[model samples]
Target: MNDSPGWASPGPAPSDGRPPENSGGSGPAGGAPESTPSGAKWSKEQPPAGQWSAPGTSGQRSHAQTPRPQGWNGAPQGGGWGAPGPGGWGGPPPAAKPGVIPLRPLGLGDILDGSVSTARAHWRTVLGVTVVVAVLVQIADIVLQRFVLPAPMEITADPESNPTEALRQSLESMQDSMISLVPSLLISTVGTLFTTALLTIVVSRSVLGRSVSLGDAWREAKPRLPHLLGLTLLLSVGAMAILTVAALPGLLLGSVGGALLSAFGVLAASVLVIWLWVRFSLASPALMLERQSIGQSLRRSAKLVQGSWWRVFGIQLVTALLTFLVSMIIVMLFSTIALFTDGSGMGELLTGNSPEFGWAFLVISSIGAVIAACITYPISAGVSVLLYIDQRIRREALDLDLARAAGLPGYGTEQPADHTPGS
Candidate 1:
């Protein structure tokens, strides 16, 4: 039977082991007694194999009569499989693309493009969700920085004259920085959690060429939010615990050599953290899509990433770098404008003093941050979801399921064992 688009016909059934009834027989009863036709004689000289022309052909073989070059499957070759030809069967038909990406194992470009295309195609839902989340996060961060967080501690000790005092002040400054960073990190994490959950759903729908509304995304994502939060917190706490443990011995020693040892230990632990992060990176999507428990999702991600660690690492790393650059550019642009608008702030910064940012600078900078988050959130989420889908397609043949989910023609149809349909 001829194969249908997006479907391959089943092969013929296995043959029985028995030989044919008339095997090795020249005549009816396995005896050689057939008479030759009158005046027909075998020729002494024969043309080499594949060189002789059929009867009624001219001495010179016509182009139409010449045997067409055979393809790997013995079909007369035109442009080869999947290449455009007279009947469009020069090669296998193009992969069924029911959505942003073709239903097949994806390349890096395909994954990135699909992510952007999903955002572009479903901008209303994607941008709407990201914008709201980003705006809220930025506003909270601005408020925290402006009112809640302590001002930068002033350093008055002279380093040369009072080295101990200066060192104490420096440590206090570092402590203040970390203290201020905690709230911002928490706010950003919460925002990312919501956005990643909602956008995963949107991107998944877009992969099937289906449009989703913000409400639909929220509804679908809400059920999975708790598990997602647990996963996020688990990872965050795990990383912190590793770092803390790495630095604990050095902290106990409390000496310069101990400090160096702690730093080295932390650095080594960081490498381990990065490896673990990549190994379980797909857990979010797996949890959201498969409705797996956090533990199950982690295991699933590890299983999928088992043999493709570098690839997953490279894609995630590139995505993170690109998004960081884009966000920086946007933030810098707005920051420049804010500085120009707030002359005092710019003056303070230029004078090698900490800038006391007023409402104008804060608002403008926050606006820039909001915009950056809006642009990057969808892209980051899209890549994560698409990467998960791509991995599944590669390892689990997910394209067939995606095609079926998309309701594409000729996919996911089953035939009865005893009844084979003609092509």
Candidate 2:
């Protein structure tokens, strides 16, 4: 199977044994002609900060340092400093710093940087995809909240009524709230699937050090939509079933074992659900990138996640926390400003006790939701794809393949059988 689906294709072998340029890809800056002075060789290694090195000279480094490259700012440049060819001045490859990520076995920092870099490097494509999805989802949510759902009913504690009646009323109210949330949940679910599919392709292309347009990403993702949707549904059903089974002990034994059994069951289910979620999180990337069936992708995720569960979990946790933090900051800022400007009862709105739904409130909150989604989606999707790539690198020596795919010259040999973690 090809390592990169939709992006990597085999062709006539290069005459000089150099790795062929990426199929359907332009050089670093979206297909610009990349060249260097002929006869000069560039190093395969990146020099330390503030230092440059002449190629083919071990331990011979230059003291001269150029300012950080332009692409570092996340701006799209036509071409960056190109590597010198044979007998030309040896320098960094033109695609060396294409986008945000370097093609290699990634560290945590690399994953994080790659995530942010992708958004910055291809802001137009990445943001465009996310903004359109988010705005549509938000519009759907706003419509559901403002028009379809019945107006919120104020429920007060009925001290004069029987306790049993009051409990029943509270339960009914809770059920109503849950029912009203269903449309929003469905909207979010669909939005996540579409965005993840598209962005996964974008992130994958970035890993290959190639730039892709929104159209390219959508075209690559479209055929996989059904598979991606099925995979998501499978996971969702599986999680719900596991939790239900876990809760069965509590439900059946409720009176016999009291609340202790219920508490234990809930706790155990939560732990198992989290573990499984983290473990299978890479399944989506595998399904989309490897073009595997649902079963194959789940098994592939398990295989890759087997020994690296904690590492993957930790990285995912950090990404979630970071995403949440940024989102929280953005939402809070917007909400605070809106609360002051609109003067719609902040207390009631925040506490979810408002008896009335204000159009202004819905619009403001939806705007925040849209902004947060736009920022968080790429980071979340980028981390997953990068994690999948990292695992392949660790277990399958995928870095060599990625290097060659990115058109790095020296790594064109077949991946070694004796793959070491640090290799």
Candidate 3:
């Protein structure tokens, strides 16, 4: 709220029965156009006074938080509009208290708080789902690392070894290591799909302040499992295809020129994928919450994400970084413990001096991964789901439906009578 781009604390509504204004003119404070992404918005014809500015004034004050109306004594009233004032304006009549988010358009803080509040409110169900998935993933990864992965082939000193043969041997070793990782990758991917689907459902219910048990969430999610899997596969395949295309420059041009071009192509490809990933990131939530097919979900994400690329990207990037930091901390803690207890030669194992990891190192690291996943999954999934909701509230006026669903009164109509095209 303190001059941050998108947040404004609610202030008291103006007393003159006029929409709040920026120094320049009417409209949300910022000088952004009407279709500006998310910073400010125009109210319908009957937009509550002080709540919305007229369309088109390049509202410089757009970043200012519209204050909820106040009571006679000047205390902030209940509900977004607060108690109706002298001219039938003032508060939006009384409504049920919002559970996780207010029944109004949200700011960045609201979105972030909503995610944490959802987890706190439904800790048992959310944590329970994450724990189960993380445990399964950890178990699979441990088994793959301990038993399924092949031991590296030892190479004796070849007094007359050919340079080409040595190169071939190195490539083969790399291929073997990659092969050993496939099972772990597959397990992690499957777990991610399952957790994302289930947590999305839980998060949606939390938005409506509805009670959902693990059984209810599971039942709701079960029907969409196949489609969710298909969706994940579709996205995975698309990403790989994009990466492969990017790598082509490097591949087709074998010389130094080709290598340089390939490197450039890869950098460009990485940027593209990150952009595409942010744009399509909402697909999982769309699919699970809307019961859409894989293709429909992708289209839905693209549509909702249109014109809001940077905002979505920023939120996602922050969430990802936060989760990664937490995961790293956990892994480091376990690694340190293992080091003191039994991590004698992990460096050698990593460098291929040893054929496989010792059990203590493997178990400790695996446990760290599981714990990190358990903590981070809910936060990540919660933020994604909330972002989806925020978009809907902004573009589709979903707040009304959500309010009604939460049993709030005085929001029965999508738009107030005065909120007409010609008004």
Which candidate achieves the best lDDT against the true structure?
1
Off by over 4 Å in 2: 1-99, 152-155, 158-173, 248-260, 344-355, 413-423
Q: Which wins on lDDT, candidate 1 or candidate 3? A: 1
* Model 3 CA lDDT for position 128: 90
Query: Per-residue lDDT for 1-423 in model 3, tens only?
Result: 111111122122132233222222221222233543776554322223343222223545332232222211123344333455685645333322457876565667877788888889999998899889988888878776667776656655455767645545654676677777778788999999888878887777887777788988888889889998998888788887988798786767555566567678888888988888988998888777777778877877887788889999988888889889999999899977775555456566566675344778777877888889888888888889889877765555445445545544333323555786977
Candidate 1: residue 326 lDDT (0-100): 99
Model 1 lDDT vs. the true structure?
0.74
Ordered by TM-score, highest first, the candidates read 1, 3, 2
- Tens digits of per-residue lDDT for model 2 on 1-423? 244545332222233244333322322223233346895543333322332222344455332231122223232222443445587765543323433565445779999989989898788999999999999999988877777888656567788877556655775687678778877888899999999999999998887667889998888999999999998888888887987677677666435353357568778888999999988999999888877789878877887798789999999999999999999998988777667656556666777765353667667877898899989999999999989877765555344456556544333333446887787
What does candidate 1 score on TM?
Answer: 0.76
TM-score of structure candidate 2: 0.71
Residue 143 CA error for candidate 3 (Å)?
A: 1.3
lDDT of 2 at 139: 90
Report the Cα lDDT for residue 236, model 3: 82
lDDT of each: 0.74, 0.71, 0.67
lDDT value for model 3: 0.67
Q: After aligning candidate 3 to the native by TM-score, how far in Å is the CA of 66 from where it should be? A: 11
Over 1-423, each residue of candidate 1 has an lDDT whose tens digit, in order, gives 112111121121112233222122321111233345875533322212332222323655332232211211233224333345574434333465778998767888998999899889999998899889988998899888878887767766574755445545666677778887999999999999999999998888888788889998888889889999999999999999999999889867765666677889999999999999999999999888877889978887887788899999999999999999999999999999999999898899999887887888888988999899988888899899999888866655456456556665333233446876793
For model 1, state the Cα shift of residue 278 in Å. Answer: 0.2
